[model samples]
Target: MTTSSAPPVAPAPETASTKDPATRPRRRGRTGKPPSALLSRAGVTALLALATLYTLLPLTWLLLSSTKSREDLFGTNGFAPGDEMHLAENLRHLFTADDGIYLRWVLNTVAYAGVGSLLASVFSVAAGYAFDKLTFPGKERLFSLVLLGVMVPGTAMAIPLYLLAAEAGLVNTFWSVFVPGLVFPFGVYLARVFSAAYVPDEVLEAARMDGASEFRAFCRIALPMLAPGFVTIFLFQFTQIWNSFFLPLVMLSDQDLYPVNLGLYVWYSSALSQGHPEDYLLAVVGSLVSVAPLIAVFLMLQRFWKSGMTAGAIK
Candidate 1:
């Protein structure tokens, strides 16, 4: 009478989709052959090759041109190395000529770009985070002003900015380049994007509720989250300041304060008109040297950009 065995557990029901054998992954086609993966791989390889060539074109030209002397620049194959290797000779001329003035120009460029971008990044992050999370009067209006400033080309404001600097006795000085660079509208905009994407509002609120001051919460919690954004802003501002020629051209008359770009312009102009045509090699080499640091920076810090985008996307 006690032979009641537990009823067999009902077989687990399969979903309609799972029950269809045709829906299963197949290892072979109807002809007992594997699918061709070459087309997709070939397409990707071709695309990568094209992209590599496109990006390397300018750098290739710079490299080849740097190797050529005045005569070889036009006389030899545009992409080929010259018969004589004068990189050392050209560099010697660059450093020794004019009592080592090129070194001064290099220092000035470093000062302007390195220091200015650092300060600009800080200002942009602070402003951007404030705009994103903090409530204040006319915040939107202020951000709108920044947007308007972005639309207004830097060249358009060059005269006005120079005049303002002149009035303040800042023109033709290091301040003329560094001070103006610190006010980066595009950096602010990028910072705002990063802040919005990465820094969560709730985290700030929770920190505040725990008796943290506004500044304390930002410094402790939000600031760390914004590292990626800050890095991006720094890189962008760095590049902008590094490549800036026209602003320093108009604002500063002192050769000692000239950034590399403006300094290179001087060399190019001198080579063409007043100086030896052989100096053309120096100009090309100088141009190449000016860009090398930026290239190094990009290569070194590119991971931050990728991480920032990933973190922002996940947030």
Candidate 2:
């Protein structure tokens, strides 16, 4: 006998750990997140919800108040719906009261936002694409100046812009609002980011090799790819031009040229000081109506924003 068969030859060492992949404690990813992380996430979500409630509370009050009679607004709970809904009557009075001046304001808003955003987006896209793809003297310097302009708040430049418009005899005219809205530094910056990311150099080179002129290549090849970015720029500028208050206030003395925001402000001021505080309800209703188009536009165009960001990032 070979000395008890050398103790039955111990099995080869397994080496691997006994822990199973599924059963073992996770070292990374969601399973690895500590209870503290979960608690932190919960805290963040709750904070955001509370912030949303805070922001929306005034709008909620406005809606409820708009439905109530003057007496009910003062007497009843602020959030309670009144016994009667006068929103329709209020709207009718609003539209018909001033010889349909409100409609003109609405049209003016549309024109300013539409024309301004379109022109601004075109200018921004062209400038951005040129800056990114074309090599020119002082390109970096010009871009840096644009960035500096971004840092300067529009309010600070409002007086200067007004003065320039005044000198050019543009004040109190639609051009006062439209032309200023069309020159957006932020739009230019966004366009540059998008152009750099989307319009690949190789593609431009190929287009040039095909004997396509620079403008032709851009119009035919690059512009299609830039469509998403254009929409994003348009939406942003649209919202900005639509919501602008101070510029319009400074530029135009004629109430007929007012956009919805300025028009609403007029109502609010009148409602407060004119002692017909009951008219406040109309102001609230008008506010609600004013925001509806913006919400609709965002919902419709948000897909373009997503696609554009994705396209640029992927490229």
Instruction: Residues 164-258, candidate 1: write the lDDT tens digits.
Output: 99899998888887888899998889888988888877778788889999889878887788888888889988998888878999987887778
CA deviation > 4 Å runs, candidate 2: 1-39, 83-85, 308-315
Taken over the whole model, the C-alpha lDDT of each candidate is 0.83, 0.82
Global lDDT of model 1: 0.83
lDDT (10s digit) by residue, model 2, range 212-265? 999998898877778888888899899888889899989989999999889888
For all predicted structures, in order, the TM-scores are 0.81, 0.84
Residue-level lDDT for 177 in candidate 1: 79
Please give the distance, in angstroms, between residue 171's alpha carbon in candidate 2 and its true position after superposition. Answer: 1.5
Evaluated with lDDT, which candidate comes out highest?
1
CA shift of 237, model 2, Å: 1.3
Residue pair clashes in candidate 2: none
